[model samples]
Target: MRYLKVIAQDRSGKGVADTLHVEFYEGDQLQRKATEADRQRLKSFSKTYLKCAWFNSGEGEDRHVRIFSHNPSADGTPETVRLHFHEGPVIAYKAAAHDLDNDGVFELILSSDVDNDGRADRTDRNRVRSLVREFLRVGW
Candidate 1:
């Protein structure tokens, strides 16, 4: 059996949670020893993160997890190790456009109730909308 200690940190490189220790002996064996730097790179390599469950701090800080362990695959079948770091809920947003004046130009309508609160508020939508709009306008 092999054991590993995975420590998660925030975008600022601050520890977010205690080290998550896990043990596994089944399935294919681990391929390599993931280091702190490797973990950081992995985290940062992710272009985007999952959205929050509901209205939150809107601080999508980059998170990194460092796995401290030793490879135990000796004379065993070569296998690959893949890791995915998800911080929030699995969600998607919807938007539409309406021509109020019927003149052809349509005003954008965005949904803010991603959490299904039954009410549309700016809490959950502003951050994402603003960021996207800014990126489109300023070419970020």
Candidate 2:
């Protein structure tokens, strides 16, 4: 009974705008793609992708999140796998209300950078500085 929170990021690790554009990942094994429909479907998937990530009493690497095992050979049994979510930092910029699990309203996520390299260590201060410079430019 978990839902997902969608987070979009640019290569420089910035949030995406609300217009619902998408970035696709593909390989040579792929051929002519059907991305228009795929893009629409992706939004639905991304929104709930992180909902399964939850921690118990404490936080950090010790906390593990269970994911759908997708193990189907069903004689009617539940299958799941747990992964150390702390290993990868999550960047959450927004939240929304849901009655999905009846968990009462909004679900959330916090920012962390366990390794602090690829993860976004840059903060609002950096963004503010950049915007100021962009606005004060001498030439159009």
Candidate 3:
């Protein structure tokens, strides 16, 4: 499993000071297909949010989704969406996606700070669940 560090930012190009960690596991890394329960969970979560028709994969056919919090205080410029992706301590947003397993399936596991509160809580899990569902709906 590979890890990416995503730092949410606010308008004015300031970091939200919250680091959200996500793990990317290729199908080969997991060595298994998504379980039935996983599929159900994904379905349930995706139903809670409207289909994201405006999501831009940005020059790739890998099928992906980007989710972020709307900062009302920042005039809704999607400051949170302008995330800084890092590998270890190094910024590496350019090569963010890879077919590590060569099986064409990659799983992203959000580790913490799903709610951007700098702490793990129930809300974080739910947010992660929703994200997983949405990702599977569009990314897989």
Candidate 4:
């Protein structure tokens, strides 16, 4: 029997980080589905707040959620969403592990603007380069 599940999708790629649809599932059935109808319950809901996204396994946890902004020019602008299946607060970070890079331990990937464009793309090489530079500045 399946014990845990997650569902997320990006909504847009224009300005800031927008809305995402998420849900939980068990077995082969969907337990919850975040949809437009449910979003109406919120104060401000716009199509700009929703878009398409992709998901990949992050290091150091069973799962992680990375929300990318709507900037075609910038990649690596993911708003890391921490998920804790238990009861209290659990923090999740962008990390790398042995299975991730053929290494044994885990490496943590911190948050950095990397790009000066004020937005992040999902797989931009330049943005990732900038992020690495900023992240490794050291003692500054």
Candidate 5:
């Protein structure tokens, strides 16, 4: 499996300069710089989703994509969306939320990963369309 790191910040009158950084990796080694097309795709996605702070995958054996969003409040925690993939199809979707009750721990809300028939769930595919289409264009 491969990994990609995408850095994007909100620039919608937030007094922040727009910037994008993309890098691809195979294993622990950097493969190469992102192409112009890859940068464009990330830019377009970031434009549509201004809350996106950054997105990347875990190192080594992790085969998932994590998208981190900006926090709305200064004292609030940011949300993270994870797309778990097996082979190529996205098998699970998970969202981590801030602690609403002022607890020290955060909360993780999971979408159903399996149906009654024990098959991988694809219902959340639409929710992570950008990752599937732009990054991993397989098993769609």
Candidate 6:
């Protein structure tokens, strides 16, 4: 597994305000590690810090993950290991551009999930309409 650290501090002081430490691991195997320092230097009074990683899998497909863990084994190792799994909703999201009322330039067509199941039905026009309405309202 790989380890990373992100730190956030007050802009006018020299003490750290918050820190995020992460670890990256492959299906049971460990891979590359990353941290915010890998990106830029943090001033003693910085406001925020981020440690991110973009992992590439060798299985012919592409995937990404955000890691969060907090645990330390006295032997001098991290204490916790956790990975979150996210799957796009069934309805997914598609795009279209047209003035439903044909007024002028496109109305910025969009879609939303009405079922509230966290997934949208890609093929259902009603579902698509629901998504569009939601998008128009809050751009969700």
Give the number of the best model, judged by TM-score: 5
* CA shift of 60, model 5, Å: 22
Count of clashing residue pairs in every prediction: 0, 4, 0, 11, 0, 9
Measured on C-alpha atoms, candidate 6 has an lDDT of 0.30
lDDT values, one for every candidate: 0.31, 0.28, 0.33, 0.29, 0.39, 0.30
Ranked by lDDT from best down, the candidates are 5, 3, 1, 6, 4, 2
Error of 3 at 76 (Å): 38
Q: Which of the numbered candidates is closest to the native, going by highest lDDT?
A: 5
> What is the full ranking by TM-score, best candidate first?
5, 3, 1, 2, 4, 6
Question: 1-140 in candidate 3: lDDT tens per residue?
Answer: 22222222222333322112122344325233345555564444334322211111222212222333323344422212222223334433321122233343323333344343566555654555554444445333
Please write out the lDDT profile of model 1 over residues 79-113, one tens digit for every residue: 21212222343223433233344443333434555
Q: Roughly what TM-score does model 5 have, to 2 decimal places?
A: 0.37
Summed over model 1, clashes come to 0
lDDT of 6 by residue, 16-43 (tens): 2233223345545545433465323222
Q: In candidate 1, which residue pairs get closer than 3 Å at backbone N, Cα or C atoms, i.e. clash?
A: none
Q: Candidate 6: deviation at residue 98, Å?
A: 2.7
Weakest lDDT window of 10 consecutive positions for candidate 1: 77-86
Alpha-carbon lDDT of model 4: 0.29
- Model 5 misplaced regions, further than 4 Å: 10-17, 40-125, 137-140
TM-score, one value per model: 0.24, 0.24, 0.28, 0.23, 0.37, 0.20
Mind giving the per-residue lDDT tens digits that candidate 2 earns over 16-122? Answer: 22222222213213222335755554544434332323222222233322121111334332222111232235522221112233332212222333222344444
- Lowest summed lDDT window (length 10), candidate 3: 52-61
